[model samples]
Target: MKIVTWNINGIRTFRGGIKKALDSLDADIICLQETKVTRDLLDERTAIVDGYNSYFSFSRGRSGYSGVATYCKDSATPFAAEEGLTGLLTNHEGPVRCYGDHTEYSTEELQLLDNEGRAVITQHRIMCQDQVKTVTVINVYCPRADPEKPERKQFKLQFYKLLQGRAEAILKDGSYVIVLGDINTSHRTIDHCDPSDIDDFEENPGRKWLNCFLHSDKQEEESTDEEYNEAYKLTSTHDGKFVDTFRHFHPTRTNAFTCWSTLTGARQTNYGTRIDYIFADCQLAEEQFVAADIMPEVEGSDHCPVWGQLSCSLLPSSKNPPLCTRFLPEFAGKQQKLSRFLVKMDQKSIQSEQRNELPGSQEEEERRENLNPSGAGKKRVLTAESIIPKGKKTKTAKAASKPQGSLLTFFKPKITNVLPSTEAPERQKNLDQDEVTSPQNPSVKGSVTKDATLVLDGSEQLCTSSYPKDNDQGTKVKTPHLTSQPTVGPSDTKKGASSGFWKSLFHGPPPPPPCKVHGEPCVLRTVKKEGPNMGRQFFVCARPQGHASNPEARCNFFAWVDKGK
Candidate 1:
């Protein structure tokens, strides 16, 4: 079974379809990090791919940031799935797969850590050496520490600590653990492109944490078993050890980086860091592990994919699994499309047409058919009351008339026509003196005339139409009456016109000048770091992020917002 992990940057921005990209990878299980999509924005195509079951974790704190997703083939469907590392976010029904003890962490701390939607855990029943074993895959996009924010460094360390605790808990529960995704930390000097540039490399908290987490592959001549146990106790909380899968197979493989800096064209020369990894349990790596390696040839994302092969095959799924996207309401049935809402509106219009049927036409016709079943040869008599025009009916007839209202009438926009200032200079004076109640809605009143027809749609919006004078010499000016009829050709034009009007009205300060390198528009950003320039806005290149060698790559554009002021 092949399992792949990639930091996709943004799932929605995939070149072709997301399903096509996943299929091209040809993996039994694929985990994606930095999906950068929210729950509401998830569509059927992305949420429910054919031949695959997916699980997604979306950021509750913000949209389009720090999201992860896992897709498993139909033959390898997981027995259980979960969002967020903390157990508090469980929406799964039936049997639950425990991920270890969370009692050590407070409720508030768990909630805070899980808010970013950085992790998704899945438990699969696999056949390892003829024995059914439960393997928990913890897909995590570890937080990156920003140099400007010291608190983020602590957050990153805390995340690593929590991850270690969870893995150890699962191990104690007799389930093998596989932790994978962008760890965002190079563990050794060999993993980095230029280790000399970084001072006190071993002193970094993230690298130090990783060193203690994984077991030492090489046993020192001077170190004994007792000495190793004592040293391990001082650094880590977890008693169990994990093996870096790729490094386990190729320990001395240098420059085997999975991530590169797009700003400096690092990927072009293969000058990058190997932060992405697939770390498996020590026993799992030693027994069932087949091969593990990185795929630097894939070019869609700044970080390439790393995969691990295992000899174990997933056990057949039971009739009722604890969790799966197929069971979710969004993907259970026919996917909803934009046209579904249009179909509903059409149904409403049909109902209104039925409601507007002649006062008692249906009842009278039914009565005649029932009473004169055998009188087909006899001529039916026509009543004078029925023959009279509806408008000319007596007060009694008018009282008996059914209401002529439809659901659309209430929502229809009211358009009132007023002569333009160029045509009638004193039209305002005449409007003030000759205000008349609207025939449709008497509650609102407006000035109206025969020459200029007023179509009041309830709102005070003016719709002016010129009618030809009664005299034969008068020229005719035809103005079309507007209704809410959807036409493909006009819709695009309407949106363009309306958007331009609103944009001009609310447009703020003119945008900063184009970037010098790419000559593209710049994007505005505000400084969030606490310093003299805190909250200050600046402009940078607007190009899509990519390796500098690429023609479409973002340039080194920078300008202060208040510089010219």
Candidate 2:
């Protein structure tokens, strides 16, 4: 299968240009970076490509800032998700400063990693010779090594360590992995055109970190003479490495640039850096290793596209479930008790795998081991997550469990009553506001339907119903696409955002994007969940939950938006 990575500096600029490349660069999957496209900017004309399904992760912190997208063939069996890597834990890893953060600003890097939409991973299941296998395709836009913003360099370094660790985990699942993106670092002098630009300081440090991560000399896990295999996990920054696909194919090729400066017109002189890459797993066939071509010929972006193809496939599919992966720190010196736990968990997973669920953890057992290690032999527990098997649920990560800036379970639906029911007419007036509840969800469609009625005795409230066509039973309704009806896009959108916010909520555009940007109580959003919380309205973070950009994040400014008053 063929795979490609390209950093389309401004996706909007490619209004007419994207179609050209999409047709020419036909591959099984295409990973894009620096899309600069907001959630609201996408329309049928640009977003949806025939015969292919699209997945996007937009920058919630700011409009059109940094985002990533992927387009895969609909024929391929995929887990069907658009996921971002968040909540990189600092428990086992020593010295947070090394990853470029202090206790005061601990959440800085993680927020960027999650909400900024720099990286996205998709798991696809395919069939090879009637055997099914799973493979992870990770597309990342690493933070640049910026000297002016020294902290950014630290952020970049931290990103490298976390990404390297993540790659290790994905591979442990017995899945073939392909990591493609704009790495933004010239791994060696040969990768770049100018030798003087390749200094040992600043950007060069990234090369050192990358080198250590990919080719560690340490013997991480050694099998012993015991009855069972000595399984192990490496949590340290320097673990093992990825096979850089480009270098693997053309080891001696020079001046194979992928990005150049638009200001200096460096592409004209062939003066550019080979920062973008597609790194395949070492297990992949050397013969299947095809050329990593630098397509400088592709126009519409400062960075050119990099393409590569592999012969074999990891054919596997998933029974899509909410995944929680807890990374285990380096567990050395103490292994006997944990080893027993591993054996038990493995056996339990066999039965659980049949159910398409993971083996639930024994929280009590884990608590005991963590509290008193001296009792390790008496009641043992594993510190980190083990390998994720095929067709089974992905691991639930501990750091990621409550990574929501102390706002755990932020996105889980809740019913809120911020106001009282008495002030009906006016509260009804704000409730009658058009276009806010515009997100394309089943509930939204139900709300605007003619049959949808409000229980306004301090219960569910009223809203506008923009029905274009009525049902035959007069109960039936027409589903109007967001675009055919004037597009109500982002607050400060990249393009195509004429109307602000959703039309079902507020009448005009949102005062700010999602929730109000800074200070004070932001606009209220409604949530409908099943169970007791069913038919209830809850208020949540407007800037998108779980991925706060900063520690001072979260309005923590909690209050209910009552159906009345």
Candidate 3:
């Protein structure tokens, strides 16, 4: 069965994108990241296909934040591990009490909050028709590099540890585990467009975070320096424990990147990187794998969908049997004869038409001579008399006598010019006589003025008046209000003198309260310097705006805000 993973950005915003992906790929299983929607917001019909079952886990943050969902074609449920452990750990405190004597908790009460305050891990167990047991798929979106301070390094490491523990538990189960979705990490020099441009030695919290999974066993031996950091172990570990589906499936392909730079609009160019991935268990390596770079054609999302297929045996009972039937001899013979007769008729008609129109033939010369007779003795032949059937002559004569133009167009101007003065005024007078009519007109008119009401009504009535007569007995005629004309004001005249003052003060919503660093607001506005990136306003730390005394107190909490732009 085909399986696909995609970071859908926001489910509501990119709902169409999800639908498009599903229609194009038709995958049996789909894992989506950053759905940013709770169960209440999902459309049952649009989000879940008729025969498929879906499960979703939302982030603890407010609406429009990190969330993940999985859609399976067959019967499956969310994998609920033992001990209230939802295969994810967060920075927030765990449950103080247990529901039952057993350490295991129900999936209904399980919660997996994001510890790094970045993203949550959502896992789904899909049962294939092949009865190949359960396939656990985990969707992940990791934290990004924070420029506010250096404390993010520690938090990133902790987040990775939590993920590693979950992975180990899943693998120990001995089922086919597929860790897919946007891992938000790129390994190897080929994964990035310009790997050398950025300093590899610089402290990157996200890179360190990925190392937790890539170098789980050798974390102590790996160098702390980002340059020497071999967390992903591009050469060995991937092939051993996990399989990089893209590299393994499409080895000869180059520039097979998923995430693209929205600013440049180029496919796998300078700013493009392969941050999205689909990692499969080593056991499934022999099964044929396929990875498609769908970034070039699709729009809306920064990361494109990556899909793979696994060949597995289906259970005998699941296979559908062919239907058995027979055709009647009499009906079959009649159908065959009808088909042959039509084909012969078509061929005969084609030959007859061709022979009649042949050039230099007797029939062609005679037809030409009849059309252009040059002899003085030749009489003017009336072709119409010969061509017209006996009784049709009277009908044709009557049709020729009538005017060629349509009846509606012939008297259009006259009808329009006469109706308004004669019928419209009386009809409007009768309408105004009833108090109920004007009130109903207001509801129909919406925000339109009286003149607009009259004009629209007159156009519908096909009135041709240059100036309609005022039918109201008490009201006086007034000039029509032109909505497009600018209103002159005393304040508008003074604004020219104080333009600079207003321009300086009006800097668009005061920069979104500054990004918080270490639980306090930071002064630096990254959005002002960087411009709009996605729909977020990024910020760096300046002097601490609140509790922190040292302006340099580093913290990973410095983040971007949506601000409802």
Candidate 4:
């Protein structure tokens, strides 16, 4: 499962980036901070995406102030939602003082951080291994302390303390926790573009706010009307119930910023701060990380999208065949394993022998003159005009029978499927008619083409991918090459242990299926339909060598893809 946390700055203006993130990364959940739009002003487009459920917490007492929103993919569900600091509202010290403003807020307003909707927590049910567990994701748009206003700065600190306490309380309920969003505090100097850009360190309360959460300055402070927040804690600690996911993975890394200041032109100059983050519990952080990267390309917001993938024990789709894989009878057994290069070689050898020696009969006299321009029989042809109905031109074959139960791969080869390269060589789009017939509305008899979408995978069958390169740098972005035509045949054996698996998977078009009746090769054919069997591919019987068409040709046996695998 992939999760993305991005400070969109404002939902009204930033939804475009949300769409791009969804399309580009296919994240499971997207947490947006500083969504300035309220429910009343939220248009239909902003409230919902076609395949996701959206939840939002709009700011109170203002049209556009502070807000947070979470988008959950259709596959996941959020069972509960809590707005603001919930019970923490009653635990505040008292009414606080601000720098410039003399006016003091009431206890309720101060506790709730002026009802700006800085946070919202949603509980999602996730399937982990064999059991179902809950994950509470708290999306927070923590207030940024205003340099000119002392009250806002104090409120920001208060909000931070409340958020930390609430997160701890949620953990007590036994659910995995992911506290995500724009915390609005640069925890370290490396978090921002440059350390020298910072101003006051000792007198700055906002600077102290981040250090407080990072488990620094652990000395006990004297108690007074002002209650100082506790020292920072790690996700594994009871006191520090959250792990900074990014920082944990890249402890010493620098120059990874999530938010930029447009007014100061920080983004243009690459001088921004990494304020937004996805903080999770220790267990999830340690064992479930799949990828952690800042998507600098996603546009339409002051802050770029930051996303990470986790191999959570949810669905087992990652281990199964690709969702697009399908089966057809024309490619049964030996049919899909035949290498195109090998087939051409075999055909070339047969053509030369036939051209040098003529048949000894009148029946051979008719077949002697080479019908194909390529000096070879187009393919191992097999089909009886008598067996085929007089008027019908095409046949629709059903898929191979499903296994008795769910397929559990006992010895399935562990091949690292690589994403295709963008600069792959280009070639013709259409499959050669003689090599692999194109299935049409009125399909004619021919060998099933390698380009058909039908895919059959059994214990011994090979499954190939066009993209075979490794990406050690990070998570790989899948290329469009595999979905295109197969350009290269299987590569020769390689150095790694998985080299054999790679060889099998990257093989060319297979030889025709074996005929059960006459031990001849069954010619593969494609079945095209406007309905379910659009990409169907399979094979029919081709008479064996030295055998011409006869009245009794029962060798034309038909089978579904990989039926004998």
Q: Could you tell me how far off, in angstroms, the CA of residue 281 lies in candidate 4 after the best superposition?
A: 1.7
lDDT of each: 0.71, 0.54, 0.46, 0.54
- State in Å the error of residue 372, model 3: 99
Query: How many clashing residue pairs appear in each of the predictions shown?
Result: 6, 42, 2, 21
Please write out the lDDT profile of model 3 over residues 300-346, one tens digit for every residue. Answer: 57778887776653221231111100112231233444443233223
| Per-residue lDDT of 437 in model 4 | 20
Native RMSD of candidate 1 (Å):
18.4
Candidate 4 stretches with Cα past 4 Å from truth are 14-21, 87-107, 200-207, 212-239, 313-565
Question: What would you estimate as the lDDT of candidate 4?
Answer: 0.54
The candidate with the higher TM-score, 2 or 3, is 2
Q: Which stretches of candidate 2 lie over 4 Å from their true place?
A: 87-108, 128-130, 201-203, 215-239, 285-288, 313-565
**Could you arrange the candidates by TM-score from highest to lowest?**
1, 2, 4, 3
lDDT of 1 by residue, 1-565 (tens): 8999999988888768899999999999999998988776888888888988888887664456678999998888887788877776786664334556676677766776777778988888899888899998999999887676676777788788888888888887899999999999997777887777788766688877997788666542023334434444555544349999997888768779999877546677687899999999999999999899999999898899999999999875664354565566566776766553333223444444444322222112111111111221122233455468767676566578854554544433332443442444366465443334434444443434422222232222333222222223434433233322122123556558867999877867556789999787888878865679988888888765544555776677888887434
Q: What is the full ranking by lDDT, best candidate first?
A: 1, 4, 2, 3
CA shift of 230, model 1, Å: 16
Q: Please report how far candidate 4 places residue 29 from its true position, in Å.
A: 0.5
Clashing pairs in 3: 83-104, 91-115
lDDT of 1 at 413: 32
Instruction: For model 1, state the Cα shift of residue 151 in Å.
Output: 2.3
RMSD (CA, Å), each prediction? 18.4, 23.3, 27.1, 32.6
Give the per-residue Cα lDDT of candidate 1 at 32: 97
The runs of at least 3 residues in candidate 3 whose Cα sits more than 4 Å from the true structure, single-residue gaps closed, are 14-20, 75-131, 149-153, 201-240, 251-253, 264-270, 287-295, 313-565
